[model samples]
Target chain A: AQSVTQLDSHVSVSEGTPVLLRCNYSSSYSPSLFWYVQHPNKGLQLLLKYTSAATLVKGINGFEAEFKKSETSFHLTKPSAHMSDAAEYFCVVSDDRAAGNKLTFGGGTRVLVKP
Target chain B: SQTIHQWPATLVQPVGSPLSLECTVEGTSNPNLYWYRQAAGRGLQLLFYSVGIGQISSEVPQNLSASRPQDRQFILSSKKLLLSDSGFYLCAWVPTYQETQYFGPGTRLLVL
Candidate 1:
């Protein structure tokens, strides 16, 4: 079984300031982790993923996440927050037992960017 | 560029009414297709996935059924829909391996 827990249900940050969204996971296998963003009335978009690669993974829109194996965590971060960054963020874990890569998503965190 | 489309950005149906939602992907062949439902302020719940035409894998047990008549076309249907069937439905696709899955705009279904 694989599961993800987003530490924050909501996060607020001032524009131009740094942003951090925390996530923790539990998986029997090595685990593949992912972060996705969903703007209002839009579908989810992939931000980054950790698939047994380097600890630090860079993604689109000036975002990145560090996969800390020892901590069982993958936290998303950005140096500067933009107004456009206001959206819902989800952390995901894949169950290796499922062949089609069945994903288990976090409840999601709503990010509010204050200007 | 590959793109996926789901019909009727929004829908309102009565209970026990037959339901049909279609999804199609362009610029790709034999791609993996998936259908997911999202509750209000919650994560996605995968319903069905298809790897090829006429082959569908169900992830959840519900009145919903899926069909893949074409290599890139997937459809979700039910003989009758329940009031609990209403939610935001999304269709997605991925090439293979751990490639990122791309989602459609999503269909907001409200059953009354």
Candidate 2:
């Protein structure tokens, strides 16, 4: 079984400040991790993905996430926060062992950027 | 470029009504399609997935069922709607050679 837990249900940050959203996962095997962002009533957009190739992954919108196997963590981060960054962030884990690469999503962290 | 699409951006239905939500993918072949539902302020719940035409797998047992009649088309259906069925439904597709999935805009179904 594979699952992900988003540490924060909501996070608020001031503009230009660093942003961090934490996530932890439990998987039996080496898993593929992903960070996705969803704006209000919009489709989910992949921010980054870790496929065992890179421990530190860079993604769109100046976002990045580091996969820590020892810690069972994949935390999303950005150097600076922008108003447009306000959205729901989800941490997802997929184990090929699971049929069809079934993805398990975390509860999500709602980010609020204050300008 | 691959794109996923879901129909009836918004729907309102009464209890016991039949429900249907359709999803289609373009620019891709033999893509894996998935259906997910998100309740208010909740995480996504995988409902169904299809690896190919006429092959559907249900992740959760509920009033809903899924059908894949075409390679890139997946449909979710319910014979009787329940209030709990109201939620934002999303469709996603993973290219045959890709691991990351792309999502559709989603359909908001409101059951009364």
Candidate 3:
């Protein structure tokens, strides 16, 4: 079975400061990890994904995440947080062995960017 | 490019009312379609998924049912809405042999 856990339910950061959202996963097979952001009342937008390629993956809106095999973690980061960056982020894991590529989603982390 | 569409952007229904939410994918064929529900302040819960027309797999057992009448169209229905069913419903699609799922704008459902 594959599952994901977002370490923090909420993270507050000042505008222009760094932001970090932590996630950890458990999967039997090599997993495909993804980071998705959802603005208030909006649909989820894919920020980035790690499919066993580069350890460091860059995504839109200056967001990036590093996949650590040893740590079993994929933590999202932004060097500088913008006001628009305030949103809810989800960490998802997919196991190829699973039928239909079903995804397991974390509880989500809500980021608050204070101006 | 592939795009997913969900209708009834916002719905307010009473308990025991019938519910139907439609989702259609454009620019993709024989794709996998899924329906997810996000309760307030909670993560997404996989409700159902379909590999092809008339093939649906339910991940959770609740007061909901799904159908894929067409290759690109997936419908979620409920014979009666429960207060627990009130949440955001999202439709997503993944292309054949692809692992990435694209989501639609989602329909906000409020059961009163």
lDDT of all predictions, in order shown? 0.91, 0.94, 0.95
Predicted model with the maximum TM-score: 3
lDDT by residue (tens digit), candidate 2, B1-112: 7778899999999999999999999998999899999999998999999989999999888999999999989999999999999999999998886778889999999999
Question: Which interface RMSD does candidate 3 score?
Answer: 0.6
DockQ of each: 0.68, 0.87, 0.89
* Reproduced native contacts, each prediction: 0.65, 0.81, 0.81
Task: Give the clash count for each candidate.
Answer: 0, 0, 0
Evaluated with lDDT, which candidate comes out highest?
3
What digit string (tens of lDDT, one per residue) describes model 1 on residues A7-93? Answer: 999999999999999999999988888899999878889898888879999999999999998999999999999999999999998
Error in Å for residue A26 of model 2: 1.0
Ranking by lDDT: 3, 2, 1
What is the Å distance of residue A62 in model 3 from its true position? 0.6
Better of 2 and 3 by DockQ: 3
In model 2, which runs have C-alpha deviations exceeding 4 angstroms? none
Winner by DockQ: 3
Look at candidate 3 and tell me the lDDT of residue A104: 94
Provide the DockQ value for model 3.
0.89
